[model samples]
Target: MMSNRWLILADDLTGAADCAIAFGRRGLAAAVTWDVTTSGDVSPDDSRPLPVLAYDADSRGLSASDAAERHRGLLERWLEPDRVLFKKIDSTLRGQPAAETAATMAYLMERTGAAFGICAPAFPATGRTTLAGHVHVAGRPLEDAEVWRRDHTYASANLGFVLGTAEIETTLVPLSAIRSSDLASRLARIAEGGPGVAICDAETDGDLARIAAASLAVAPVPFFIGSAGLAHALADTLAPAPTGAVHIPPSRSGSLIVVGSLAAASRAAMRRLAAQDHVVHLPVSPDTLLGDLAGRADLAARVAAVIAAGDDALVEIAIGDALDMSLGPRLARALAEALDPIATRIGAVAATGGETAAALLARFGIDGIRLVDEIEPGVSLGLTLGRLSIPVATKAGAFGDAESLIRISERLRAVRTQGSFS
Candidate 1:
C-alpha cells in the first residue's frame, strides 16, 4: 500500500521534529514548520506535497484558550480529508494538552461528521509509559517527576483528570483490554458512541504497537493524541515507501550547541558536553541577556571566535534559584538575538529546548526543518530550509541522558563531514 499522508500537529518545535522524524526514519519525507499562520508556511518544497508534514503551533507556553484557538485555526486551514491527523502531546503531560485535544476533537467532528481520539503518550525508549491512565516517567508518576514540579497545568497525573479540565469525555482502556485478543473490537466499542477520547494503557513498545494496529482497524479512523512513541508505533504499522530524499547541507565551520532548557537532564548534558576538549562553554546570565546589549554582543563575538578557531561553541543560559518560568521566552529570544550574528560561522546547530530552537531558527531566517534521522530516542536531526540550510538537531528539555548532548554534537559533526547521515 502507498504510505498515508500525515498532518502532525505539535505544541512546540522539538515535539514537532521528534514526532515527524518517526515517519522520516521509515523512509517517508517528513518536514516540521513552526509559526505557521498561512497554508503556504507549511509547504516543505514547491515541487510536491511531503508524505508527512508536522506543524508546530508553538502553543505549549500559551494559556488553555489561546492554545485551543491556535490548534483550531491551524486545523481550519490544513485539515484535509485525505490527510491523517496526529495530535502530538508531551509525553510527561506538560503544556495545554487537554485544551488542545478538545479543540482537535471539536474541529474534526465539525469537519468530518465524527471524531474520536486515541491517546497513548508513552515513549518507552525514553522511559515514559502510561498505566491506569496515569503517565509515568522512569517508573515514577508524572506528578512526582521533576518536570511536573518545575512546570504543570494539571492537579493530577491522571489522563482522565487532565482531559476532564476541558470537559472532554474520556474512556480509560486498561492494559487488560490492550493485551487481549479482541483489542480492535474493544476499541471499536469505545469509539462507537459520538466524539470521545480513549486513554490507552501501554508499558512497552509492543503494547503501543498493538494499540496502533487496533486503532487503525476501527471505524472513523480516530485521530491520534500522543507523543513520538505512538507516532513510532503508527509508522511501524505502515509499509515503507520510497519518497523524496532529504538534502544534507555541507559543513562550513564548528557546530553551535545551544541549551536553553532548565531541565536537570539538559543541564547535565550541557555540562558533560562542555567538558569536551574541543568544546568551549559560553555561559550567559539571563539578566545580562535581557538587559545588557554590550554583554550580548561580546558573547556573540566569543562564540564566533570559538567557531573560527575550529572548536565547538556551547551557549547556555545561566539560571539562578530565584528564576521564574515566565521569563523563559524573553530569555530564549535574547539568547537567540545574541547568537544571530554568528549564524554564518557555524557548521551545524544542536538545541536542547523547544522555545530555544524555534527562536534561534526564526532569528537565523529558517522557515522550517526537513527531518532526516533520529540521533537518539528523543533527539531529531534535520536540515534547516531557508536562508541557512544547515544540520540542526533538537532534543526536548527533559529527554535524554548526561551524554545525550555529546552524542548529538558528534552526530552533527559526522553529518557535516559525511554530507549525509549515510
Candidate 2:
C-alpha cells in the first residue's frame, strides 16, 4: 500500500488550501497551515496525523532569494521520510517558481542522494494549459493574459525557460510522448538519466492524469510539482479511503464576504454578488484603508450591523484606473486591520486572494484551516481552527467566473443552516 502521508508546500494561502482540498475531496483528511516556525502550529489536530498537510510559506511577495530560503526552511522542518512532497506553484507562474523549485530539488538531493521532479503546472479546469512547453490561459499565451501583464517575473511563458532562469536543468516531455502508451517507461528512462526536472506538456485533465500515473510509476518516487489540477490527478492515483463523517459547526449569523483580489474575475464576481438583495455592498478605497482610520472604523461598524441583521456583507477594495501590484500585501493588511474588530460577529467568511485570506485569518487569530470540501474547481471550503471556528471559503484571485462569489456565499449560508457539510 502506498504511504498515506503527504505534504504540500505552497507560496501562498489560497494555493495551499486549493491543493490540500484536492485530497480532502478524495475522502482523505487534509489541513492547511501557515506561518510555520519551529514551534508554530503545524496542523488542525496534531494529536492524530492528517493524511495530507499543506503549508503556505507565505513567500509569494518575497524576493527570489528570500522565497527560496523560505521553502528550504520549511522542507528542513516539515519533510519526513514517510511523506510525499508536492510543491505547489501558481498556475500562471506569477511568483519565483524557478527559485523555489531549485531550492526544493537541492534539499531533496541532499537528504536522499537522488531527487527528480515531474512538473505539470497545467490546471485545465481553470483554462490554464501547457502546450509545446508554453503556458496558456483561456487559449491565449500567458504573456498576453492580464495577470502576466500586471505581474510576471519571467520574460516568456515557456516552462523550460522559466526553470532555466534558476540554472536548473530540465527536460521537456512533449504532449506527443505524454499521450503515448509507453509514457511510464519514457518518464522512467528520463529519471534514470540523473537528477533533473521534467517539464511535461499537458492541455487537459486526462493529459495530467497520464503524467501523474507515469511519474508515480518511476522509481524513487519523483516529487510532484504543479497546481491544484495536477494535485487532483495525484490524489486520484492514491485513491485513499474516504472518512465516514465530517463535523461542521452551526451558525446563526450572516456570512462575511471579503474581496481583495485584483483579478478581473474576482471583481466581476463581487459585482454580481453585490446585486443580490440580501447582500450589503461596502466598498473601501485604498487610500482610506491606508490613511483614514476613522473611515476604516466606520466601514467595520457598517459591516457588523449588516451581519447582525442577518444579511451578507460584501467588503471590497476599490480599484482605480491604474493600481500597482506591489500594493497588494499592504492593502490586504489594511483591510484585515479594518475588519479585526468585527471578527467575532462573522458567522462564516469567504475571501478572494491568498494575501487577503491569510491576513484576515491571521488577524482573526486563526492558526490553521481543516479542509472539508471543494466549493468549486478552485474554491476550497474549510473550518478555521483557532481563536474562532467558522466555515471559510477561499479562492485564488483569477480562478473563477462571475457567479463564483455568489455560489460561495450561498454555500456558506446553506452550511450554516444545515449545521453540517457532510
Candidate 3:
C-alpha cells in the first residue's frame, strides 16, 4: 500500500479547497485551513492518525521573493517522515508559481537527503494542459487567454523558462515519455540521484493518472506538484477506499451567492445568475461598501431581506471604470463586515474569488473547511469547520463558463435550500 499522510500547500483558498477535496473524496478525512502560524486545523470528528491537511499560504498577491521566503519557512515546519508533501499551484499557471515551486523543491532537498519534484500542472476538467513544456488553454497557448493578457507577469507560457529564471533546475518529461511504462523507474532514478525538478507534460486526465501512478510506483515517492487533477490522481493511487457516507444537513433558508471577482468569467456568470427568475440580484458598489457606511448598511439590509424571503440572492461587487488593486483587502474586509450580521440566516453560500471567500469565512470565525464534493471542474462544495458549519461552494475567479454561477446556485438550492423550506 502507498499510504502516507498528506500535506497540501496552496497559494489561495479555492486552490486549497479543490486540492484537499481530492483526498476527501477518497475517504481520507481532509480539511483546508488558513492559519497565521501556518499550522492546519483538523475536523472535530476526525481521529485518523494522518488526516489530510491542506494549508493556504495566501501568497498569490505577494512578491516573488516574499512568496518564496514564506514557502521555505512553511516547508521547514511541515516536513515530517510519515507525511507526503504536495505543493498545489494554479492550473493556469497564475500567481508566483515558479518562485513557490522552486522554494518547495529547495526546502525538500535540504530536509530529505534526496528530493525530486514532479510537477504536472494540468487539470483536464478545466481545459488546462501542458504540451512540450508550454501550458495551453482550450488548445491555445496560455498567453492568448484573457487572464494571461490582463494579469500575467510572465513573458511566456513555457514552464522551463519560468522555472529557469527563478534559478530552479528542472527537466521536462514530454508526452511521449510520460505515456511509457518506464516513467516510474525514470522518476525513481531522478529522486535517488540528486536535487532536480521534473515538469511533466499532461494533455488529458489520463496523462495525469499515468504520471501519478508511475511516480508512486517508485520506492521513495517523489514530492508532487500540481492542481486538483494531480491531487485526485494521487488520492486514487494511495487512499483508494470508501470510508463511509457523508451526511449533509438540509438548509431551511435560501442560499446566498457572493461574487467579488472582476474576471470576465465571473462577471458573465454573475449576469447569467441575475437573469434567473428564482434568483434575486443585489449589486453593491465596492467603493460604497469600503467608504460609505450608510450605503453599506442599506445594501446589507436589502441582501438580508431578499434571503429572508425564501429566494436565492446573488450579491455582487459592481465593477466600474477602474479597479484599485491596493484596495482589494480593504474591500473584502468591508464586505465581510456588512454580511457578518446575517450569515446565519443565509443557509448556504457560493463565493467566487479566493480573497472574497477567505475574508467572509474569517469574519465568521471559521478556521477550516471539511470538503465534501466538487460541483464541477473547479467548484468545491463543502461544509465550514470551527465557528460555523454551513455549506459553502468556492470557485476560482477565472474558472468556469458563462452559466457557471447559475449552475452552482441551483445545485446549492437543491442540496441545501430546496425542500427544507417546508
Candidate 4:
C-alpha cells in the first residue's frame, strides 16, 4: 500500500502548522512536528500531550560533523537520509547566503533525490523568513514558472513555485507569496471551529494564549497550548477568559489540561475547572511535580539524568525528558515495585528558556539530537518532543500539548474501557 504520510519543508513551526492547515483544508489530518533539543518544563497529569523537541547550542552535537551525523541518523530513522525535500523561500541577501542554500539544496537533491522549490517572495500573510536571508527565483525569473506565483506584500516579498508541484508536495511560501487576512474572520473561524483540539505553539505566552482562547471560542473540546513561553503570553486572557471560560462540563468533549509550564497559578486554575466537572486528574498540580523542580534548574537536571540513564534495552523507562519533580527515573524506580521493565518515556516535553533547555538536554548526553529548521528561529510555536518516535511524553505541570498528552489520556481511557490494565 502506498504511504499516506505527507512531509513538508517549512520555514518554521508556524509555517509547518500553516502547511498542515493547508493540508487540512485539502482534507487531511495534519500534525506540525518538531524535535526537542531543550530540557523539560511541561507536564501532563490526567490531560494534555507533551510538546515537540529542540536542541540548543549546548548539545554536544553542535559541531558541524556531529550535527550532520545527528541529522543523518534522524533521516535514517524517518525518511531516507538522502531523499528528503528542501523548501526554499525568496528574499535578498549577498553571495554565500544564496550559495549556501542552493548548495544545501543541490547536495540534498543530488545525493538524496530531494529537489527543492524556491519561493522568491517568502510567505506574506505569515512571518516566515528566508534562512539564507535572500531571494530565489526573484524578479524576471518566472519564465518557466507553473505552480508558483507572485506575492503582493511582505517584509521581503516575491513569489514563485516549482514547475509541477504535486498536492501536498514540497512548496516554498516565500515572504512574497503570503496572502493577508482579516483578524476578525480568522478569529471567528478558529473560535467557531468544531470540537477537536486547540493548539498554540507561538513563541510568547501572550500571543499563543490569545489564539488558544480564540480556538476555544466556539469549540467545546479541550484547549491545549504548547510551550510555556506562549502560555505565559496569554496568561491574563486565559485566566479570566473574556469570551468566557467553558468549565469542563460533562457534556463537553475532552477535559481541559495545560502542561509544559510552571506558571503555577494558571495550572492550578485549570485543574480547579476540571475538578468542578469531576473530570479525571486534569489541570495537574505543581505539588505533584515530585522532583522539586523549581523551573529551569529542575529541567536541566532532568536532561542530564536522561542522558546518564541511557536508553539501554528497557522498553519504556519513561521514554522522554523529565518534566516536573516526578521524573521518569524516580517514577521508574517506583514502578519497579510491581511493574516490568517497560519504560514509559515520560517528561519529554519541556520548553523553558532556550539556553536552559539546552543545558539540561546537553548534560543528558543525548548525543543524537538536532534542531529542526522551521522550529529554529523567527516563527514560534514551541513544542517539546513535538515530533519524533517518542511513544509517550507530558508537560511539567498544566502546560498542555496536543499529541503526546492526548495519547496518554486516550490510552488510559481505552485501557479502562476494555477489561483492566489496572
Candidate number with greatest TM-score: 2
lDDT of 1: 0.88
> How does model 3 fare in lDDT?
0.82
> How far off is model 1, as Cα RMSD?
1.6
Instruction: Estimate, for each residue in 1-422, the C-alpha lDDT of model 3 and write its tens digit.
Output: 46657888899999999998888777777878886542443354755454688888888889999999998887777656777888998877778998998788777766766667888999888889999999998899999997787677578889899888788788888999999979888777766667778889999889998998888766666788899889888888874656665556666677888898878889998998899987899888877887898898887788788878768878888866378766777888899999888877887888999998999888978778877778888888877776677778999988899999988887778767442211
Question: lDDT for every model?
Answer: 0.88, 0.89, 0.82, 0.27
Alpha carbon lDDT at 265, candidate 3: 88
Per-residue alpha-carbon lDDT of model 1 for 147-226, expressed as tens digits? 99988989999999999999999999999989999999989998998799999999999999999989877777789999
lDDT of candidate 2 over 1-422, digit per residue (tens) = 24567889999999999999988888887888885542222445655567788998998888999999999999998888888999999999988999999999999999998889999999999999999889999988999998998889989999999999999889999999999999999899889988899999999999999998887678888898899999999888876674755566677788999999889999999999999988999999999999999999999999999988878999999977498777888998898899998899898998999999999999998988989999899999998887898889999999899999999999998887677876
Rank order by lDDT, top first?
2, 1, 3, 4
Off by over 4 Å in 1: 1-3, 35-45, 243-249
Point out where model 3 deviates above 4 Å: 36-42, 418-422
- Candidate 2 has a TM-score of 0.97
Clashing pairs in 3: none
Instruction: Give the better candidate number (2 or 3) by lDDT.
Output: 2
| lDDT: worst 10-residue window of model 3 | 35-44
Off by over 4 Å in 4: 1-5, 8-25, 28-68, 76-258, 262-276, 279-422
TM-score per model over all chains:
0.97, 0.97, 0.94, 0.28
